[model samples]
Target: MPANFTIVTLGVADLDRSARFYRDLGWEQRGDQAEGITWFRTSGSWVGLYGYDALAEDAATEPVPADELPTYRGVTLALNLASEAAVDLAFARVQEVGGTIVKPAARTDWGGYSGYFADPDGHLWEIAHNPYWTVVDGRVDIGAT
Candidate 1:
């Protein structure tokens, strides 16, 4: 199989609400109507928002109840910025959109600055500035700095 990472779809409780949250972050959806799902284009991948239980059904897996979903889902999506100031700005934008600040932006022991936040459905997003990596045009390239 080719090593191409193309899409990241998030299963959300209320599709419209999730769409709005992302849209508030300045992301434009593919279509005007979400019907039951929506898609937003990103620098390296496409982000999809679909119904929580419906997504599980499509994957032939049992769906976790919304109330029972754990705070940390064992996975996190990251937005790597070009500078420390950019990371700070991202955290501020997240808060402006009502995202829960899981970890306030601060200097990390790894010699970078980072912080975490949770969306309405408890999906964790890390906003970070990794000095070891190069971020050009909003995409991270390893070992290129």
Candidate 2:
């Protein structure tokens, strides 16, 4: 099988709260799925939200206590934008929707603009715009000069 990722499941403490957070960010939820789970169809993939314990049980693993998780979980989701202005706008929107800003948007050493934020469940999301990259139909394409 091809190594294609189709879904991203976020184990949330409160499904309703997490769902609301995403909704407040202007994301529409897909309600046709089974109960006890929430889904959102993104440009290219799907994002899901489920109860932390339930998700752990579904995965046949123990859920780590929230406190036991490190400040930096070492994984981040990204939203690629077309320009620095768009990146700044997205960063502001994230803050407006209750996301905690980890880093305010600014010019990066790689000649791009980017910032980071954490959702209600502390999932890190980086909003960035790389001059050499293009996002088409939610897929990123790196164009070389």
Cα RMSD (Å) per model?
Answer: 1.6, 1.9
Looking at model 1, report the run of 10 residues with the lowest lDDT sum. 28-37
- The list of candidate 1 runs beyond 4 A from truth reads none
- Can you list the residue pairs that collide in candidate 1? none
Q: Residues 18-64, candidate 1: write the lDDT tens digits.
A: 98899999887896544787899989789999999999999999997
Candidate 1: deviation at residue 106, Å?
A: 1.0
- For model 2, the local distance difference test gives 0.87
Q: How close is candidate 1 to the true structure, as a TM-score?
A: 0.95
Q: Quote each prediction's TM-score.
A: 0.95, 0.92
Residue 58 in candidate 1, Cα distance off native in Å: 0.2
Name the top lDDT candidate. Answer: 1
